[model samples]
Target: MLGPLAAGAVFFPGLFLVSKGALRVLLGWSEGDAVLVSTRLVSSLQAVMASSAGWIISSSCRDVMEDRHWLTEAYVLFATPYFAYDVFAMFLCHWHKQQVKGHEEAGPNGGAVRAALSGFLRREVLMVLHHVFMVAFCFPASLLWRRGKGDYFQGVLFLAELSTPSVCLGKVLIQYQKQNSVLHKVNGVFMLLSFFSCRVLLFPYLYYAYSRYASIPLLRVPLVAPWQCNLGAALLWPLQLYWFTLICRGALRQSGRRQKPPGS
Candidate 1:
């Protein structure tokens, strides 16, 4: 467990530096541009790894609550570092963007760093909170609270990352000032679809799966489910719905912009 965790600590930051340097040399992108893209690239890779692990664990399990897969706990431990790393990566990305925008001007010692950190927290408070919750709460729940059961549930939760690549692509397009392009528009639609299906509806699907397995009605499944499971879903589902609505609104705004007259 510690080995995988330590490896992840090394892997993500190492990948970021290597990717940043490669983008700077090979693509001639600015430092800010490279950092932003490299961070998103790392995120997309993590998402792919998670989705793949989810598929493997889900497919291997016959009983949703009783079956265990080696990858379930192992992947969770491996991924734990990613959340911590991403917070720092996100801060780096934010700092670079702020510098590009001149939001951080030369000032008293440490003043610029403090301002950048404040802005980052303000802009990304929800996302930062989400990552923190995953590491602090969800980590222990997956590893300890289940008492070695419900690896299938952990697998399904991992599938929630399936939407991340599209999300990353949308950010990349916006970063390059290409949000008006056809590809960005298409990716916006795809992000909406993927985010809705994979994130927003995921918890309900979990309950439905449990219902099917337990031979109970869908509504009844929640009532009889373990309190921890119910509490976790209750806490997470609303956040997913909130993010989905934000994505939907953003997509609508982009669609509206795309439909306007050229001069307008």
Candidate 2:
């Protein structure tokens, strides 16, 4: 648990820094302005990440309590409300977006609102599916690891997770190469490394927990330690680096106009 917490702590700061820096760069802010805005933004994002991590840790600790039956019941009780809040939040976002655009006049051949809504809905649906799959896969995989039969299966799943990010990186690289943007090329490389680290180190631990401990009879013992959690969170460093690289690349590209230099 300490591991995970530490990882989260370390990772969130870096993630916040990268995100804030990227935003500043994109907006063409000077270094001083970027640093100032990034500082505030990162601080706010850090608070949110810390709060979320606390809730998760607390929930895990509750699950491991000695009063087994009561703990299980408590877990369900708390989880329901938490999940409900998430659902409500999603709805609120959609409603807010609709309200913001409700008064706009529809233009000729303009389906901007529909297009935006459709894209948002699509992305939301995919995000939900991704979470569902993560839970479903992690749960069974963890059980299998605990039972000593999940090694290979977990390996495969880990590979799949790793592959998805690699594919994403590859696509980014292909685009970068086509655009001949040095910044994007560098970003692609960093992102590839980031994804690789996540797939290699983080997924294995996740698989171990999901396969072995999620369903374990004991309520108090965390499958993994906080330190391990922190280590997992460290994956964010590479992720942040990758994101920064991408942002820098995009900013550089957008800041200057260049005509196509040569024929294919």
lDDT by candidate, in order shown? 0.90, 0.42
Each model's TM-score, in the order given? 0.94, 0.30
In model 2, state the lDDT of residue 156. 29
Alpha-carbon runs more than 4 Å astray in model 2: 1-19, 22-118, 143-146, 170-264
Q: Give the range of the ten consecutive residues with the poorest summed lDDT in model 2.
A: 65-74
Please tell me which predicted candidate would have the highest TM-score against the true structure. 1
- Model 1 misplaced regions, further than 4 Å: 103-109
Task: Show the colliding residue pairs in model 1.
Answer: none
lDDT of 1 by residue, 54-93 (tens): 9999999998889889999999989999999999999988
Write the residue-wise lDDT of candidate 2 on 1-264 in tens digits: 234434544554465457546866778754433443444344334334433433443344433222122222222222222222333334334544454457543242337646655656675764444345434443333333234332332232323232233334444344335445675456455645644554445544454554455554333323443343334335333453454466456546644434435452
Q: What's the alpha carbon RMSD for model 2?
A: 13.6
